[model samples]
Target: MNESLNELLYRSFDTTLSDEEQQRLDEGLKQSEGLRQEYDRLKTMRRIMAEQPQPDFMPGFADRVLQRLEDGGDASGDAQLFFEALWLSFRRMGTVALLLLIAAISYNIGSSDNVSLRSAFNIPETTMEEIIEPDFYQELESLR
Candidate 1:
């Protein structure tokens, strides 16, 4: 298709074309078989569309659309609804994670001699070599 006259060809169907544009479109159709087929297809489509009756909208179409627009305008509301739905879906997993955290904290506190929050989480000061040695577990077991 010739880019220069393609727009002119489509325009000739909807609006009156100038003599110069019509001549250019005619010359293009004569030069390109493909363009001529496209022109024929457009003409057939326009004729078919013109023959069909215009479709009517359902009753209350405007009211329904306006109601939807009014109800769906809040972005924050939509986000909050999505978050609430997500929380509902994963509440069981959240419960399990919370239980596990509490159990871990309780175990740490019970294992500490001091029974204080600081002792429950504190790491004993030790050289890196002692932590890596095989005897570390044996020494820790003996202390217990």
Candidate 2:
């Protein structure tokens, strides 16, 4: 129940006591039979735990867990599946948009007047004097 005894007990478990702390704990253990008994019990428990064989896992344990996640067995897998679904939906929407664009273009072309391919390439003839008028050149000279 004493604060120092409690601290010493915890320090003993941590194995981080200085010489003075060790001496204090030793003195307390000598003075209190209950503290001594508790210390012994803790030591025995520590020893037992240390002596026990570590549990062995099945082969490819990590690989199996990763595989399960990939197969949509865990939260991460669910997230992956969610992203995949989102991607598929986006792809479908994109395809629909492309088809709509193509349809619109086709409709516009079909509805337009039938102009000959040669007529599209025919540029209207214009004289340079007509393009740049004498009046326009006079305005430029005035600005200068």
Candidate 3:
């Protein structure tokens, strides 16, 4: 009647109980049939576990990883292709910009002598000083 069957199971299976506690548990077993049945069930479970062993798994998990690499499933290759397409678009835009800049420069060279009667706002050559550097204009400036 005084027996804690849970405490007895913990003591019998886990080996953490004191001698006085074990003696008290033994006395409790004779006093109560319900406590004795619970204790017997716990003991039977522990005995069955000691008889059967657990299974272990195989160790070649790295083989699957190596097989994936050999099959060209790398994410870096996909990212590289995306970046290459982006770079090609940027290069095409750069070529178009360079062609427009060259055409503007050629037009200015060819249309220099066309004089008009209208007195509109005239943009000074110094405004384009950096676009056409001083050293580049030095030969033409000396002839003036």
lDDT (10s digit) by residue, model 2, range 83-134: 9999999999999999987676666556555544423333345765468888
Those runs of model 1 whose alpha carbons end farther than 4 Å from true positions after fitting are 57-144
In order of appearance, the predictions have TM-scores of: 0.38, 0.42, 0.35
lDDT of 1 by residue, 17-108 (tens): 88888888888999999888889999999999889998889999999778868888565677889999999879978999889878887888
Best by TM-score: 2
Best by lDDT: 1
TM-score, prediction 1:
0.38
Q: Candidate 3 local accuracy as lDDT?
A: 0.70
Mind giving the per-residue lDDT tens digits that candidate 3 earns over 1-144?
Answer: 443655665677667668887777777778788787887787788799888887655777688668778878675677889999999999999999989876766666556664432211223444545666788777667788
lDDT of each: 0.82, 0.78, 0.70
Candidate 2, residue 123: the lDDT equals: 38
Q: Candidate 2 at 75: error in angstroms?
A: 9.1
Rank candidates, TM-score, best first: 2, 1, 3
Cα RMSD for predicted model 3? 16.1
Compared with the true structure, the alpha-carbon lDDT of candidate 2 equals: 0.78
